[model samples]
Target: MDELSWFRVLNPNSKNPDGHARSYEIVNQNYANKTIAEFTPHISFTNYRACQEYATANLNAGCPGKSVLDYVEEDTLELTDPVAWVNVGFHHTDKDEDQSPMPIHWQKFQIVPRDFFAQKPTITEARSCVNGPTGGAVNSTTRPCIATNTELPTVSTDTEDPTTGTTLTATPGAWNEARTTWNYQYLWFRDGEPITSLDEEGNEVGATGETYVLTAADLGSDITVKVTASRTGYPSGTAESEAVAVSGGAEPEPEPEPEPEPGAVTSKVKASATKVKAGKKPTVTVTVNATGVTPTGKVTVTHKGKLVGSGKLKNGTVKFKLKAFSKKGKYQVAVSYGGSGKVLGSSKTITVKVKKK
Candidate 1:
């Protein structure tokens, strides 16, 4: 059986001199140790030399006065190969709950990530999507900056026996959320197209947890399903199951990969005002035009190499409302198109003048 475990992250820029940024600890306990040893043997070591001597020491007499933690606190000696030890022991008090057939117990350790990232790793930029410089330009509604959950959920499919199976069923694992509850939506697919379930009245409905009965038309296809989980305020997440082939059906044909498009898409950025007073918000729009294809990707704006804003492209452009500048100066604003699979990337730089507040 697999054990359940989690880890923690630490800030790398922490001022602690020990540089104890990250550490992973694993502790395993054996109940037999309590009975066989004098001091209830605990794994402890100072350095490579002490570890060598301790391993050779007789089990009859465990380290009498030197625990690994003790050595760490007391000894200032530097070591070439240092080792830290941790102990996991089940605690018991003289209470009624300490019966013979004990309830499930756990012995665990922690893995810490110290000073891992300079900032919150998942932060996203604030920006808005608009059609153009028309009525929707300044009035565009900004999409809330929500991070997509990339952790795939677990799904299993059951089809009874291989010979006579005509129906397949799928089950989804619980979506675990820390601060809120998760609601789930499921979708079923044959090959790559969607499949829907029908209610008793024959009205189409969601295919969540529904059985998929095989038909003559679906004889050569494989079946798969996907589940999306979302909370009221949090971003939504999606996960898909591995495709399950029909019992005695022809193998599904694989879809061909699209070839990479030839020419690169170009980007041009224009600000609403060439000059604006400090603390005044200005809108910047990036137009990504291709000769023969529509560009689909994100546009990122940087001011003197610092990321200012970013947004996704709709139609052929992405718009960003620049935050107010606190200081007045001439700034170089650069916009880059992070091109999609069918489009190559391009960038453009422009200058914006900011006056005194």
Candidate 2:
């Protein structure tokens, strides 16, 4: 599951001399084929073009040779409800240590939410230092600067996700005194810095207006509006609104649960006593093991297809105090494991003879 951590982005892979460079593929699903060579680069019988960086246009329509950032800008992300087909894997080479009695190697990667929650999801009241503070009094009681004659402008947005080109509105507050020529000048900010964007002519200019439309540049940044209220008789009184986060991304889904593969099941059965009194029950233990997985599901003691008794498996085994044999004769009992998804069921049989009391 993707979640926000203190470390959101990874530093340059080459920053660490010992670290291997990580690769990413964000495209269509026809990228992989398992029938051929191991980690094969599919060239033949494929029309897909290799991806390149910072391309102005998609030269190859069959398979655009653009990097993920370019692909997101020009094609896949333009329309709403779009999907980015991302595939991740680590290909390793066999070393001397990877031979028989080899040391197991594991690789891990994370895909976390970019901007899904309003606040940090890990924050809680139990953690008093959530924002890095203790419940103690401070030496200086600092407060916001306010004036009786001047009121701060309230900033609001149609949507937090600035990627949609939503409108940002700054309503003028009640400025009672020195009302005449109370000119309001607006300047947008991103993380406390004046926000600048390029026009159609590609010129940098400050975003200044009572109502401004959010640009793609505003995405994944903290946005705020600073409004300066001025009049002929009074000095300019500037007040800024609270900053809002524009991390316009969706919540990530959790990984699916793991289950054992079929055709590797090994079932076994053991009885406390093969011969028991007619009225006494037989203690039957059923064990079902699989390669690389622990068996879990229903374990049953049966006669032919008829279930004698059913029990749940725990830690790959289950014990059943089966119904006592009535007649004085040798009989067969089958112990079965009702399998789970992708896991084939298995059964074992044992002999139990009933003796007269």
Candidate 3:
């Protein structure tokens, strides 16, 4: 189509240069064959009269001068397998500009983006790197996003010494750092039906909270405390205590074992950039810490809920170089420290946005 005039679609309010779809075309002096006659006269696109005529026309009939739209006599435009018609012209006849050794003349145009991106793709903000004793230089090229997780957090129920006249205590599971909000609910079930009681406020309630005291009605019956936990981004979860039964008669019971003190290790994750290009790796640093002690552990990394990488900690820090994603979008990374004998396991998560290279 280098011998005819051509044009492009434009959005007047677009922020892109020339307000077009990132392309430029100039009017010329030649015409291109983009009609049904030029369409190879093969398969019919629809049952319309124009489509049937174009598909069955003989080659000798030659291409028509009128545009494709002229063939449609109907008021409302409707067609299958639509095709665009564009013509470009560039006449190369004898002229002052066509001298034997005339310098090459060039015309350039481009379609710039407008709203394709919510904001500028390269407008990423800098972030702090995870700094631990064993830490290396922080990555300075990645773009960061708010990370989120969908996996349900671990949930468990605890009971006070079962021998202490059937007193039960419930301890909620730890919440993930990515979670923004959550709550807990306690319930007791017998023979698959819920058992409830009136709270001190005289409101009817189920066996609730972190503690439960056995009653006379519980004798010779199985008791269970179920704790339901929820967080902002992850799915809600319920954990039930192992079924315990009230004995037939009062008898001497073994002393309950003391609970082990929980470790105090915590961890944080830092990413080189919140935004990165597809096929470009992003460096992630995880720092493990304990309030009053040095931390040691094997760190595991997960994207979403799937494990992606793992490594051993050195000087309370672990680093991971994520594999380049083949496509562009937001991805979440979770780093967890599987604590040593003196530390507790902890995790941190962050979000990364991938862009075109």
Q: How many backbone clashes does candidate 1 have?
A: 7
lDDT of 2: 0.54
Model 2, residue pairs in steric clash: none
Show where candidate 2 strays beyond 4 Å: 1-150, 160-162, 178-181, 199-203, 249-357
Q: Per-residue alpha-carbon lDDT of model 1 for 258-304, expressed as tens digits?
A: 34556544434333324675535556777787767787777777776
How do the predictions measure up, each by TM-score? 0.26, 0.27, 0.26
With candidate 1 superimposed using the best TM-score fit, by how many Å does residue 165's alpha carbon deviate from the native?
A: 5.5
- Whole-model lDDT, candidate 3? 0.49
Over the stretch 1-357, how does candidate 3's per-residue lDDT look in tens digits? Answer: 332334444434554422334333333344334453443221112323433333223232343443333443332555644343322222345688666786675433333333544335564322221212313432322211212123322213254334335666655544332323457777765423467878789988776666677776665445555667653323455655545555443333323322324654444433333366554556667777677776665776667554555667788776776644534688877766666666656677777677753
Q: Candidate 1 at 108: error in angstroms?
A: 64
